[model samples]
Target: MSFFDRFKNPKTAEEKKRIRQERLLLILSGVLLGISFPPFPFPFSLLAFVAFIPFLLVIERRETLLTLNKATYLMSFVFSLITLYWVGSWQPESDPFLMAGGIALLLAYPCVMLIASTLYYLSGKIFPKKINLWFFPVYWVLTEYLLTLTDIHFPWILLGHGQVKFLAFIQAADIIGTFGLSLVVFYINVFLYKAFSNYKNNNRYSVNYLVAGVSIFLLFVVYGLIRISSIELPNRKVRVGLIQPDINPWKKWGTGSLDKMVDDYLSLSQQAVDSGAQIIFWPETALPVYLMGGNYQNEVDKIYSFLEKNKVTLLSGMPDIQYYFNKEDAPADAKFNKSTNSYYTAYNALIELTPGTRNYKRYGKMKLVPLGEHVPFSEEFSFLADIFKWGVGLGGWNIGKDTLVFKVPVENNLGKDTISVSGLICFESVFPIFVAAFVQRGAEFIAVVTNDSWYGNSSGPYQHKDFAILRAVENRRSVVRAANGGISCIINPLGEIEAETKMFTKDVLVGDVVLNKEKTFYTEHPKIVTAIISIFSLWVVGINILLFIKKKFDL
Candidate 1:
């Protein structure tokens, strides 16, 4: 029968029953995947290993590309909605635009997932039946990698991230990175799905496939155990303090006076200092205003004074601005200021303020949150910036150009020494390779500053904190995260949480973080795994297209 014939005719009872089963299975797959995400607890994440089996079963039954993609969209749609429902900050005090953006993301993410399913369908058309099912992982990995390159990129739900709770299973990330873990997960799903299908058909090789899948999983577990048991962190440690002020996101922007906020942060830092903190870190936008914009000299002086008195370094997130009188000297996307008759750009930036030196280092945030920070493709379609801005004035920020590794000098009882650390401003921590670049450059440890209060006490904040575990494991670097309104914590090189702060509380955490001078295999060769998978995905597409050309022209 033709593909359209079944739809054109009335459905039979058996066919209707089969359709119902497929729908239920797809929904189950999505739910399993969603609940398997981080902050859900440990054994829950184990479901990720088998989450795709039901989805794959549906794919196997669908013969046409349209049917296959429709199933793909349905399953991924449920998955996206369940896991990313918190993106919009759907709270009474949340901005309407922020909520709207969140809804839009849930709707659009399924479409992005469809890219992989559609490519997999296309590959099945060219490859032999036995060889086609294995291409799903390559296509999915390629899609995830490609998302990192786009303007509206959000690789938030990369499959490997789900396995963070399985500490022993993920220690391999140091060598393969998250992408490799994702590959392992996908292949295991494929093997298990194949085994189940064969068993139902009474095939003899069912047990072989099941054993292969289980064996591969245990192999990684054993490797993780060995790495964790034998791994040695450096003796060199830096005593650091993280401050969570529990500030309300809405009030801090316009209503709160800059001086009062600075004072509050200083008071919190004083507490951390009293605990013997050599260096203090505050959450993102600790100072919402431009501290060095020449208008807030008093506030700047007060911060420097505190730094000098306490004999410590203060690193915090602040809004930074740059001005250009000549149009040629400004970037093409620089904003125009009519009052000043100049082009100026604003940044969501980080600054380092040390006690005795007036010279401070700054790093503008590079990986911006789309719609939340800046509109994607706003460079060409600048009007989108004005239309899609967040209600709290966080919607339009210029992308930073340079990657900076801050050199912090601290004095201990032994002597005065300098250490290098990478500062990730909010959403930048989610990018594995991006974080690795800082380690490759010279950063001995990772410090993240963020304000997740906009999302309130939702899964967004918790999930955001857990991703730091992967970064820590992948680079073998200790991570210190300071968040406004909670979940501030420190993670060691082994992906273990050393110290943590609860959500929605004003708190201070102090911990000694290890400083590693050596780079991990993943850090040194960040792109190797993803690059290889991308090439194979390209070959799949290239081969499929060539076969189509040959069949169409009889060549």
Candidate 2:
């Protein structure tokens, strides 16, 4: 028998029925949590909220703390497992073991869930009088709010992500950020829980309860539909050429060579310019060649000349290097690296290259790709760090501490106008906070450069396309993405895909992207409000701790 079976006693039929229902809830929670991960449709998220209701209704009310704790762990485990399993599947054959190990360690969500569950459990006891029908919703909001502030945030498959497919309901994300939608989902789930619990307990239905349960929903549904339909994208003066360089990451890094890589991008960029393109963008690492000033000056000079001759400002990703210096040998606040072979640098970064112009900017990616970019803190799964066949840079990739915002002078029909745009390299598009920061820093338009060739030609690119839509909605900003190996798209603030290219195809996605100065709540200040909410939750936990301590003394 299982270990839990030994502790169990034979139950009567009534008790058996309750236990069965609880088990069903747990399984339902697991499936919903799994669906919340990508490679599935967004409408599936309604199931997550629906599933939470049964657990709240059927699980013993007194054991609410413990029951939810188990539920949290179970759901979190399923989520982390399904989401992170791509590590092993994508790993090169030689280092499959390392990929397997890294996948386990990087998945720290279960522990985070366990912590949140414990805090809420104590609140259930300490605030017993105030643990109203809204308690569960409040607790869930607190957890999500806390998750974003902490360093170990992997904001993939958020509740707001679930509405990427449903553009009408999601347009409000610009005002409240993705968290607002998440709050609504929790609100509905908690209301449903209260409804189910009340109905199951008695034969009579309370009209007061029904109104209390669904009133917010009715208001939200009405307001959401109205806002989505009423608002139209205001005209802004801006035009950009999204550079879609279809290059495979493996071949670009391997013996297959970067000759095609360099030629294809340069040729496409020239074409965009000839077609009256002002600002051109290339996908992440589209220029697979390493750029070290002076040393690779000859190679780097050619790219610079191309930009100036074409008279188009080119924002592209290349292999960027900085010198690594020992901390002891370097002065505090040193601007440049002074260690390796006459001024080598310590990091790899995404750099902005302007033709005929000496002024350029570089932004190191802040959130590195797990395993693919960097390893987790603990060495328990350190073996997983060694698995990238085409991946370079040892130890870890350098993280940019602040927002990498830049401006470029462009030639438009309106006149010689300067546009402010920020680059979100690869996975950063999925991170809402990062996107918000760039917007806050006067980035009128969001430009994302990605090399989706890592996942091959499959659902990976399609899934990423979903997030591109979310970025536009969540920030209330127009977004243009340049992807290597297809799915390059231009999305408007209203979550409309203006134009998109197909997967695994050599294609150009052309569209008119407008630049706007109209700021949304998320774009103005993304995490500042959420940070306040998270701080209040800590206070709630503190109060619960005091109650726990006082009770212990009384005993």
Task: State which candidate has the highest TM-score.
Answer: 1
How far residue 150's Cα lies from its native spot in candidate 2, in Å, is: 4.8
Candidate 2 ranges with C-alpha deviation above 4 Å: 1-21, 36-39, 42-45, 58-67, 79-87, 91-98, 105-107, 129-133, 149-151, 203-209, 292-294, 324-348, 377-395, 457-460, 552-555
Q: Least lDDT summed over 10 consecutive residues: which range in candidate 1?
A: 2-11
* Model 2 lDDT per residue over 150-179, tens place: 335556656666667766667777767777
In candidate 1, residue 503 scores what lDDT?
96
- Model 2: weakest 10-residue lDDT segment is 332-341
Residues 123-164 of candidate 1 have per-residue lDDT tens digits of: 887786677889888888878887788688898999999898
Q: Identify the leading candidate in terms of lDDT.
A: 1
Runs in model 1 lying further than 4 Å from the true structure? 1-10, 551-554
> Deviation in angstroms for 418 in model 1?
0.7
Clash tally, candidates in order: 0, 6
User: What shift in Å separates residue 526 of candidate 2 from its native position after superposition?
Assistant: 2.6
TM-scores for every candidate against the unseen true structure = 0.97, 0.86
